[model samples]
Target: MNDKKSVLRSSFLINFAIGLLIFFAFTIGLTTKVYIGGGIELYGTFLLALLILALNSPYVKHLSILSKNQALVLILIAWVLINNAELGRGIYERLMFTLFFFLVYLFISEYNEWTGFCLNSIKVLGIVYAMLTVFFALNTGLYVNIVMPVFADYTSIYQQNYAFLNGYLCGFTPNAAINAIYILAALGVCFSNVIVSNRRKVTSWILPFFLLGILFMTGKRGHLIFCLIALVLVYFINSSEDIINKYSKFVLITFGLVIVFIIAVQYIPALANVFTKFENQTEMGRIDSGRFDIWNYAFGSFLKSPLWGHGWDSFKYLFEPVYGYQINVHNVYIQLLTDVGLLGAIPFYCFFIMSFKHVKKAFKFYKNSTDLKAKRDICFALYIQVFFLLYCLTGNPLYDATPLFLYIISCAIGEYYYSTRNKT
Candidate 1:
């Protein structure tokens, strides 16, 4: 019994460390590169997580049985990697990120009881991220002029042309798209805390809206739309007749707050800037903001090599000559189809379909569950999954550490909940 307790404690600490590393990596956009190296540096939090796994190898068990959906995703990932092998080092980096997250998922699934540790760790990280965002927004000049320059060497992409009322608050990453997703994920964590009763009602209510405020500050219309949609889904899906009755006062108060915020925004000229920017950007001529041109060029390239397609990370190479500036396809599905062709896209599509199916099953199970915590966990996982699906429509969430790690964590928790319930 003592030995078992020690193992559990050690596992929880390791999981907590992993969670912290993931959040740190996401905040800094350190997903692909670590600075310390002569030729080949370590990449992201995966190496640290991998070392922890090695230390705990005795506790790690090989998965003897995979659900059909799980097996299909693995097959799809393998197919994508195998066909893109000619990309060499580029492909290897991508493979390592995927494999590291996969191993983390497997470990968590096997130790299903540790889901609480993961949730608490993420909640702490979310709170810190939210605080930083608020601070940066309030001091945009300081962040841009002082903080940003300090990390100039690590910055990958910075949009100098995009204008915002207060200047975009990208936190550590220069890419507003990545910053938007991080804010959304932080909101999900706050929402989960509210549902689980792990946080005070007031704190829970304020945190999400606060995070949403930062998200809007980033001027990412797609992310803001998808986040609102995810929140609505989470509320309706998890709200039972009894639960609704219990929280009716809280719900009414929240509704009142939204109304008050809207009225206040109209009176405050400064507050109206964000809304005006969004309205102006929605004009039919400016809606896509030049993405259509890039998408068209990418599609044309795909047509040239329909079957095998360009190699991994080949979109920029193929489009830059024609477009004059290097840009991604902007749409992940289209990007995959263009990069790997029809054959590779089959498995990629299958992976998402399978993942959704698994989450749907878990959602249904928890909806009927008598345990409140189980229901909250399921709802939280579902919200994150929705965010992932919606974000993929406009950005490549698969390649980024923030969204990918959150997706993996949510799926692992859901799978653990489903498996444990069945065993009982």
Candidate 2:
């Protein structure tokens, strides 16, 4: 048994290392500029690692039993991909996303091992990113034009405009929306650790504050709001009385500081002026900076084919005439509606809802669990799902690899826990 566990651990670490490298490659320009036959040919290393892990994983034989909802979700994904292929648009992209989702499900179905590794990995990466941001801020004095050329291309144009705010913490991919997702996911892991362990480690307290600071500095208002909501939900949804008692004071103090900061911003002239400029950058009424027009256009496109919808990647073509450039609708639900229509969306919605249902079951199971590690694992999984669900409202998480990877892994962890509970 020990030997088997060792093998599993080794495989997971190898796969995880490959995944991190792939993430950094895209972020830092290693593979971002690499293309073959006029198409970006990244993910070769990630796919190979995934293939190896799948081969070694005992769960491969039981893939069909991974979750009660897996089959239905798979069918829906197939339907969408088929429809996109029929339209001769976005077939490659949709197919890649489908494969990535399947692999995440397969790997994370190992439950305790793979899921724990993933959660820890997220926390570590978050801390590393936060520290890097601080280091860069101090070294460069938050200069706008002091970017590493290799990493600069991965950031969004809007982020580039306020590069001073981003600092050098972005590593490779510095888009504010994406950074927000990373920070929130990491924070969820750390929060779960505190709750599950029923003790507050120094890292637990420090890491969250560091991540929150990074999120605020990103100037991504939508993500910041999502993070706040997720944090509050995690705190209340956690059913551990001991954990609550231990950290309740900290939570209250944090809220108090936030309120005091707001009051100070209003009273201090220089601070108020800075705050006003920040607000202007993130304010929804800023036309080009706002998502309202993009959402409206996506809705109109959805209305065009309410039943079947336009195929995947159709929004760019549909909206370019009006917006004069191609971009996502900035809302996952609206994007799904525009891409797959109501028919395809029904199963898609069911897939996510069912995933959350498993998470809910895991939460209840852990509430009564005696094992501290198991309890913490489920809590972390639940928090990650909640964060993703809320973040998806204002971001195209479906199209982004990092966020999508974390979301599916959380679902798989929940499903795994739910299945284990039933077996006993």
Candidate 3:
């Protein structure tokens, strides 16, 4: 019931904390995966979250950081480690991620106002990300002509493959799906800035579509659709008819295209085939990318261990033997149920519910907020939260460090707003 003081100050130290996140995002493409002993992996973003939490923990010495119920998230993390059969680099990595994320959330939520700084960092990241996407997307030939010959030892067969460039634009990461999430987050922040601003800036209106183009080219069907849908919804939800009057026609045009896209992917054979090509590539003559069978098998695994679940990455062990290779389940919600079971999953998702609540509170409180700073920050926090939650349905952004870190920070800022709502 009591409000906690910010253990960390909003000066240079806070910038350092925010800077850690920026570093984590930029390095997603550069970092190699390494597993520590005991199935725990110390990753760039996860390490940054720990580092941020450690710096603030001592400052609040005896004070309890989490409200009573919020601490239950830690229990699910411990449960993952209880059964070694379910323990591995993936499982324990998630455990550590959950622990550090929540601990960091407690500390960082204290500085809700500092979120604008975080969004600024993301703006920088998004712009650079767009550049990287463009460069790499356009320069697949460069890697073949230069990188493959000079750095043959460094380039993997996958990277060396000339056809690799023909696929989605991955920017800095080897994975395009993860790259798309960052693009989505970047678009959310930049567009939020434009939407919530009291000033009239023409460039602000263009940056989001630019990012949208960047995301569209990634070949990530779910993220692209989700983004278009989000943009349309936010314009209506966050803007009044008169407020967005100038942009309404464009928004409606875009929304119409999005709806046509939805219809095309179902009723139109040519457009539907474009969307289903890769899905059918993995499974000849079949659509849904083989995800239907994966989800079914993974769900069956959950039935076997509904209480605690099979463990982190349980889907891999269950589906790999049948499928021959391991790919993510695609659906994070099913992955959670498959890996951790309903019991373990409840705690993991609790913070999402909480953070979203705070964002809703902030949105309500600041519905008429004129301050561009508050509006952008709150709107961005809300934007990415909704994206992340929904993307889990047919995508796995949470499995990657970059998007997870982005989502965690966005949500924490919302929590911050809720913590300070009454005071303001």
- The CA lDDT at 155 in model 1 is 60
> Per-candidate TM vs. native?
0.83, 0.82, 0.80
Q: How close is candidate 2 to the true structure, as a TM-score?
A: 0.82
Q: Candidate 3: which pairs clash?
A: 29-172
User: Higher-TM-score candidate among 1 and 2?
Assistant: 1
Candidate 3 structure quality by residue, lDDT tens digits, 1-424: 1223343352456667667656655555443332223233345546765565556543254575665324554564466566434445534544455456656665676665457667777777777877777787668776456534543343455653632444556665555565677777788888887887777587766787677767766777778777766676666678666755747777687788688667754643333422544674656755576788888888888899998787666677787788798777889988888888888777767767877777888877877866667777878878887888888888776676666777777777776666667887
| CA-lDDT, candidates in order | 0.67, 0.66, 0.67
Regions of candidate 2 where Cα sits further than 4 Å from its true position: 1-30, 33-41, 62-66, 85-98, 141-148, 155-159, 163-172, 201-204, 242-251, 259-278, 281-284
| Candidates sorted on TM-score, descending | 1, 2, 3
Rate residue 401 of model 2 by lDDT.
Answer: 68
lDDT of 1 by residue, 1-424 (tens): 9999988778776776576556544655343344445224444445766666545543345435765545665665566666663356444655566667766665555444555666666666655665675676677777767656655555632542243234555665655666667678768877866765633566557777777766766667777888888887777666555665747855786799778778866753433445655677685467676778777877888898887778655787777687687667778778877888888877778767766666667777767666766766677788888888888887767766667888887777676666656665
Could you say which candidate leads in TM-score?
1
Residue lDDT tens for model 2, 16-46? 7446533532243333455432224445645
* Clashing residue pairs, backbone N/CA/C < 3 A, model 2: 27-172
